[model samples]
Target chain A: MVEITVKVVGQRTRRLKVDPGTTIAELLRRVGQNRETVVVRLNGRIVAEEERLKEGDLIEVIPVVTGG
Target chain B: MLRCSFCGRRAVYHRRYAGVFLCDRCLIKSVERRFRRAINENKLILPGERVAVAVSGGKDSVACMHLLHDYCRGKRCELVAITIDEGIKGYRDESLPIARENAEMLGVEHHVVSFREAFGATLDEMVKVAAQRSTGLNPCTYCGVLRRSLLNQAARELGADRLATGHNLDDETQAIMLNYIRADLSRLYRLGPGYSPRQGFVPRIKPLREIPEKEVALFALLKGIKVHLAVCPYASGIHMEVRDFLNSLESNHPNSKFMILRMFDEIKPHLEAAVPGFEARGCESCGEPTSSTLCKSCELLQGLGLMRRRKNLIFVEPS
Candidate 1:
């Protein structure tokens, strides 16, 4: 298992343990977010949803939608 | 790891609708190409004209300013920026600096008009009064009408040929759907890329209308641009609900937003014939262009007791 930290900018931060070879898409799904409303970054670099996670990987999910 | 479909570099974004992955460079290029295409295809701008961009310091507006800064150079167009301060204490105050910074960075002239100065009340104050008076209108209705009026007035005073706003594909689609739901054909007809010019009203143009909200935010991030990412406190309404519904639909069916936009475009021309002629006249209260005697802004202000009729003229009461 790999432990990862997901920080949702302007929201909350969560650390979770997941299986190896988990994709960012899977992580977001676990956290109740989807790709349509956010952009994901892994280790300070923007990444695609298909990018797999590594041990101690730090992911940032920034919600890009705003009203008004 | 996946590679960019075009350049074979490590991909950064998966454009699901297009079935392709893009690296940072390719993504930037793709965004720029589409922006130019939208402008050219719609003839949104003309050479040697001045465009006043409405920069609210958000990702979409900031990205629009930056892209227009570059695009305007080749076209020999002058770019100016206008930021409307709606007097939301924590929100608009925080964004004003970011908007100023980007305008200064691009050496574009920037102007700010506040709700307090124009309407004699801050949005917060107006909301309080509205609640106290039991006005059954949402805050967005007031903000939308007043802010749009301020943008037009500022742009016209600045001698801008066009007032540009940062409305992305998501916003456009949501508006389209909302108007459809409300059966407001007049507003639906006015949702095209360029609005027809009216006396006392500078025509508005939306250059970022084709790009999705996510891509605009991502473009700003990849280019190291700083943007204020705060959402408004008074953002809940039917529009927000529509936004969520559309987002979910787009998530399940890739290109759903694009499909809706395409369908709107296909049927938009017919809306003109159905809606009939619109005759714009100066509002009796504010002298702004409107289809009726009083502009929507003046009506909202009057409803909130922020303005009163005095000696055959409407004067804003000091709140």
Candidate 2:
């Protein structure tokens, strides 16, 4: 299992271990996070929902809706 | 003409059982058909591309998603439904379940993205902040900018080739008026049924651009699509003023909306020539594709003390 870091916007960052073949959407949903509340960028590139993420991937999930 | 039970307006016919009566002026068939043709004419969607429909759980958006899903059946193109949760206390929560249920019933892929986690604050918070900074300006101005930016980014992440919105004829007409009121010539030129893809920006297409507001409601009812019938609370006082103005115009002229659209068509050539196409550039602060050195989304974040403000200022919209 590869270690991955998930940095959610407005929330603290967390690390997780997963297989390299996991889809981004699946990983997001697995983390008990609503897929609708955030957008994920893997290593500076926008990660598509169908994208299979690799081990040691640093992902930033940014929320699209803003208040102010 | 049959009078409407709710609004008490004279309609051409009564739908019976549904109890909603519509006049030729109210029926949206002609407008819907015209909009369909306009979308086809503009070549907004390719044969096999996937389109993400921005569903707002309203009559217009729901009808748009359903129509596009049905229209693309068995075709190479597929339809997906997406909703943006603005994090308004009671508004977004109520609409989300309805949007999800509609997507499930339609057998299309659906996704929701929220504002609280994304912006470090909810819309209610943002409105409070903005109000504290400046009085009189509505929260909708910020909300519209934020929602548009989010939808585009979310659609891109979803691998959608095109983004479809349910902006009907009335919306389009009001937008025209708003642009005119602002004297924003560039935006007025860009307002229409189609938007082409730019370097970093995904293309957005409006399939319901020609459909009237009333017809969209009728279509939703006839299609049996579950839609949130409540008006937005945030839309109660000020924004309703603009809508009431438009409604008055429609009531007096009946075909006023269509006439306004026709005016757009007449001015299309001039508008295209006068307005420059959208250019995508990396945001100086966040590297997002923004019209300016920094994107509006980033700007709002900076204003909210979330993202750092970019020092390099390129293009700024005149307020």
Candidate 3:
């Protein structure tokens, strides 16, 4: 099992245990986020949703919607 | 690991619609290039024009401002920023500083017009009073009409040749689909690259119309452009549903947003021919251009008991 941290910027952060080599897409689905609505960063670098997350990966999800 | 299509750097974005994997540098470059292409293709701007950009301090708007700033650097076009504060507590107030910061960072002259200043009531107060009076109107109805009016007025007062907005492909597609769903031909005609010039109205141009919303967000993120990334608390309704539907549709059918935009463009000329342009007259109450007797903002304010019209004079009651 791989343990990783997920942070939805401006919302919440949580540590989760998942199977080894979890993709960002799977993490987003687990966290109840739509791929269309947010951008993902793994370990401080922007990454594709299909990019696999490794152990100790710090994934940050930044929502794209904004109010003016 | 997927390699960037343009350069073999680490891929950061996988554009499913185009089947391209792009690194941060290539993504930023392509987004900027697409922005410039939209401007050039549509003739959205010209040399030596003073442009007022509607910056909400959001990803799309701030990215629009940033790209426009870079595009206008050598073209002798002046870029200014205008932010309309709808006075939504915790929403507008939070974004106000981000907008200011972005404009200051770009050294662009920024102007903030607020609902309180223009209509004598903040949106929060208006929403409260509206609820108490059973107005049955959503907060978006009030905010949209008022904000558009204020932005235009501010742009015209700034002597801007054109007012630029950061409406990406997703926004363009949603608006097109929504208008089609409502069969609102008049509004459908208005959803082009540039709005038709009218008296007392600054021509509005959208340069980011070709880029996708995700690309705009990614561009802003990669470029280190600061933006307020909070969704509006009152962003529910049919529009949200349409946005979600479109997003889902696009997810399943990649390039659907671009297809919708392209389809609209193809039919826009026909739509324009069928539906004649609106004849706007100065509002009797405030002299702002309106199709009806009173402008929408004035009508809303009057309906909410915040403004009263008497003998060609309108008096706003301070909230």
Q: What does DockQ give for each predicted structure? A: 0.78, 0.01, 0.56
Ranking by lDDT, best first?
1, 3, 2
TM-score-wise, the better of 1 and 3 is 1
For every candidate in turn, the CA RMSD to the true structure comes to 3.9, 20.0, 3.9
Instruction: Encode model 2's per-residue lDDT on B19-117: one tens digit a residue.
Output: 455434445454456656876898888788989999978777777887788677746798888898888877778878888888898898887877775
TM of each candidate vs. truth:
0.95, 0.71, 0.93
Question: Scoring model 1 with DockQ, what do you get?
Answer: 0.78
Superior by TM-score: candidate 1 or candidate 2 = 1
Mark the 10 consecutive residues where model 1 chain B has the least summed lDDT: B308-317
- Candidate ordering by TM-score (highest first): 1, 3, 2
Q: Rank the candidates by DockQ, best first.
A: 1, 3, 2
> What is the iRMSD in Å for candidate 1?
1.2
- After TM-score superposition, the amount by which residue A3's alpha carbon in candidate 3 deviates from its true location, in angstroms, is 2.9
Query: Better model by DockQ, 1 or 2?
Result: 1
- What is the TM-score (0 to 1) of chain A in model 3? 0.91
Q: lDDT of all the models against the reference?
A: 0.89, 0.70, 0.86
What is the C-alpha lDDT profile of model 1 across A1-68, one tens digit per residue?
99999999876788999999999988888998868888998998899998999899999998888853
Candidate 2 vs candidate 3: which has greater lDDT?
3
